[model samples]
Target: MRSSAVWRALPRGDLLLTSWPWRSLAYLITGVLLGEVVLLTFLATLFTGAILATVLVGIPLLLALALGGIPVAALERRRLMIIDPEPVENPHRRPERPGAREWLLLRVREQATWRELAYLVLLVVLLWPVELLAVVFGLGAPMSMILTPVLRAQTGDVRVLKFWLVTSDAEAFAALAVGAVWLALALYPLTLLAAAHGTLARAFLAPRESETGQRLAEITRSRTRLVEAFEAERRRIERDLHDGAQQRLVALTMTLGMAKLTEGAETAELVGRAHEQAKLALAEIRDLIRGIHPQILTDRGLPAAVADLADRSPIPAEVSVALPRRLPEAVEYVAYFVVSEALANVAKHSGATRAAVTGRLDGDLLVMEISDDGVGGADPSTGTGLAGLADRVSVVNGKLMISSPVGRFTLLRVEIPCAPTDHSK
Candidate 1:
């Protein structure tokens, strides 16, 4: 169905009239050029890196060589557009942090990176040379024979393919006819070769079926975590309402009933007590609502909300959040809870005098760090909120990192993507 589908176009009667042959020719030609450059670069870098390995100066060059396939594969994928209309998706995953080190570590660990290296090696050592030969024999030989008449006319006689000699105009014209037929037939094979090459490139460059399945599994796990977190949160809210505000409301009702059944000074005292109970119940309900989703977060965004959290923390907590713009509501919501839960942990478990919450936008990531000068042997397995925090973060495709030395400090760092996510998934 694709207009650029070379395999489909090969069987058509108008194959020669279409642009498929020219496109295939261009693709193969460019591939040969690219392969030559890759070969030279690979050899030079390998030799230099090997010579300088003792001094460690070539370590980076060697690393670059290892990662060289990434760029080569990217260019080849683009070149494939000449014959393959289907786009090849890059199989690399985004690094959790914004750094060259993190990016390099992630790339080296991915199977896609190694596959690309294999593809590059095959392309330079085998594929390009074969393509060069195909182009030369399939296209060049026929064109040369077709030009035999012109050569004979220019001089006295011409040799077709350096074998058959053509002296008279009739012999030259006969060679030309044969050459035309050969050229016409050769195009089909050439186009098919290009299509085969594209398929190989795609197999190496695009995400494999297994990788796609793994990604789907990861998404399913993250979604399940999100669902479990939501359920736990709902239960917490229910518990808080039942044990705090509902109990207070019931007491307030009882106090009012007692006041109505009494008289005079007793009545006034009971009414006054009932009014205080009613106010306490209202305050408890408001606190519960705020705990669920703070009004300040919805109104003024993350900075204001975090600053409010700092003000409310039992310890002297410093807040420094500077965002370029308001983030997606879900991101802000998750960020707020991460800070809230982190601060609560600090207050309850850290035994620290002070804590700080800092946030900034590192490229497209929202990087947040909560640090405290506490006796820090914080363990996620110790029934603390760190595991819950990690689960919550994973729901938004974010990362949670914790650093806590036995007697040092605890630092909770979270990196979340700034892009909006479909949480419904």
Candidate 2:
């Protein structure tokens, strides 16, 4: 049912009855018109730019000539829909930042822009002329022969397609009958040629697979940056609470304790109560700050961070992380969280008495494993939060593997690619 069905419909008997032939004609005709306009514009611009090159006034004109393919390719893609119903995706990437300068710079650097320029040059110099010839010989000659009888009737003689002389009524009628058959057969090749042209246009105009991969990589890098920024903001908030609010609470608790020593029994009891509340609030804020971002991790890096996580776990846990140097901040951050989440899962679900966290560097990779002697059947699908951990690891292009068979042990392993940042302090 689609216009692109022309290829399949060609061998069918009912092709002439379908809209494909008319659509093919439209495609070729428009191509010729567009080609003429492009040719004229290119010539005029090239001549003017060359003449004014010495005055430096021709630079913008030359730039416009180079970028002219963008609009032409866009229009050609739209016109391609006459015989191709499937839409062609625009291959150009958006500028990293908004503005004409950024857009122009990006476009000039992209391979797609140059490819489009090549297509425009081919369209004007080559493809359009072939399309024009197809229309003329495939449709024009047959129609002229078919109209022979009408021409002979008005003038008493006619030249059929300038090839055959129709001097009698019988001759003119014979040409008309033959022309009808010729036109019917000509439509088949006409539709085929149009489809071929559409295929060529798509090949030139659509984004290549490598370009798509590059765009995907760009997106991943952008996501990584956002994640790093978010982690930085978390650290900032934690620092502010620890340095600003927590210190104020500590000073207030000290003052309350001093007041309790000097006051009468009733006043001293009230001061003691106030001092206890201040201490409790201070403890809660410390826990909150740790949860937001561990200051220990910032100071001592990943090994210390993992050790701290093991220390804070409810179950008995041991840590052994040996690295030659510090890792990148983002990799360290993701690794720390992965270990934290894994230990939490172990504590909450694993019926284990003891757990161990071990880490080592395998070349450029940071490999960490947390294992426990527990009844273990961990399924990410069971809402155990392992899926979230997997997502977090993937943000840094890391892998997470789990081995938790029933009644054996649970082992959570994560490997992240990273180069050493600095020698371990």
Candidate 3:
């Protein structure tokens, strides 16, 4: 695949390239130099132990112990930064609920854990030699040419590294300089690759530190804000009732009571008018309360809640809630509001005689679907009531999708996350 396409497709592939060693032999020369650097120090340590065996074995063992923990934490942070960043919560977080050592062990057995370990082991072996070769490639390459003519003044000419392989000396400064310059330049990429390997190795070995406490605090703050917002809405409803409709209804009842106390033709006429006004006021009060929070929802749960809504709807509504039991309150609430609004829309606008409300739990989601076989032209752009419902669902991390193609069935589907186990409990 094209590199541009790969990065664009997902963050993980980008992370793999930016972090992991080049997964190809095309990176071989550079990687080998890096690999050699890492392995050499430890091998030397191990070798020294054969001579002074204790020093050799003990040194690498101690070195491993000291630096082993650093790499893993760094790698995890790097991977996270490359991928989802802030919106994605840290997956390294352990389950918030309490569990056992066995569960922890099982978690440690996952693929990412082993891959990180492999990266760390590779780093330890390459750390020293890669660093050394890189220094040689970077500086030695430049130095050989820069000093060749000048150095020839000092030694007349120095011999090549012919102790074993070359078995011959360079005649002039150019000859000795050329070999050294070429060797060093050739290894430059490998030197850089070694440094990269060492860095990645240490990073992958370190355990990822958890921000569980911080994240839980954030969750608590968010939940608190949600709770406060809900309460504020309730307060607004209470105020509306106390100052507006409630006062009007009380005044209407008083007028009717006074009218009933009179005993005349005028009194009878006044009482009838007052009675009509009182009834209107009462209906307004009922509608207001339903607007605030439907009592059917709290008392009977979602199925009966939706059924009551259907029963009162202006349009004939067929309600189907085959969920044998109640769903989680959060899920049920979103579903209830969605279905209620949908039915209200049908009654107010959809000229069709019939509508249907379907509620059920599908896997981890609570799905409430309302459809009307009416003149269907629900365009979300025109600021339909469904648009508000969609935004409300988003607040709860739910999804609302509406499909009301012209002259087709108008369907409003609200899916809210309420995992089965959560609702089951």
Give me the candidate number with maximum lDDT. Answer: 1
TM-score, candidate 2, is 0.51
lDDT of 3 by residue, 1-425 (tens): 12232233333434333432232112334344544654565466555645663655565465443343234434434433322222222234332222455345544654445655466565555543564555555545545654555556666544333331222234444555675666444443543453344345334443343444554675676566557667867898888888877777777778777877887987888777777877777877887878867888777788888898888888999999878666777667777777877888887777778999887778767778899999988775665566566656766777776777688778887778875554453
Clashes of 2: 0
Quote the lDDT for 122 in model 1: 95
Give lDDT tens digits, candidate 1, residues 1-425. 23248878888999899999989999988988998899999999999998898899988888788788899999988898999888887788765444577788999999999999999999989999999999899989999989988888898788888899898999988999998999999988998899889878887898988888877896787677678878988999999989999999899899999988999999999999988998998999989889989999988899999999999999899999998688889889999999999999999999999999999989879999999999999987797878778778877879888888888989999999986445311
Q: Where does model 1 exceed 4 Å of error?
A: 1-41, 70-111, 126-195, 206-220, 349-353, 375-382, 403-407, 419-425
Quote the positional error of residue 316 for candidate 3 in Å. 1.7
Cα error of candidate 1 at position 424, Å:
21
Give the winner by TM-score.
1
Tell me the tens digit of each residue's lDDT in model 2 across 1-425. Answer: 22456677777788899999889889888998999999999999999998998899998998898898999999988998888888887889754333588789999998889989999999999988998998889888888888998988888878887678889989988998988998888888888888888888888888899998986896676566557656866887778777766776776777676775676786776676677767766777787778767888888998999988988899889999998888888888888988898889988999899999999999999999999999998887787877667767777877777878899998888889997666444
TM-score per prediction, in order, is: 0.70, 0.51, 0.42
What is the C-alpha local distance difference test score of each model?
0.88, 0.84, 0.59
Please give the ranking of all candidate structures by TM-score, highest first, separated by commas: 1, 2, 3
For residue 339, give model 1's deviation from the true position in Å: 2.0
| Global lDDT of model 2 | 0.84
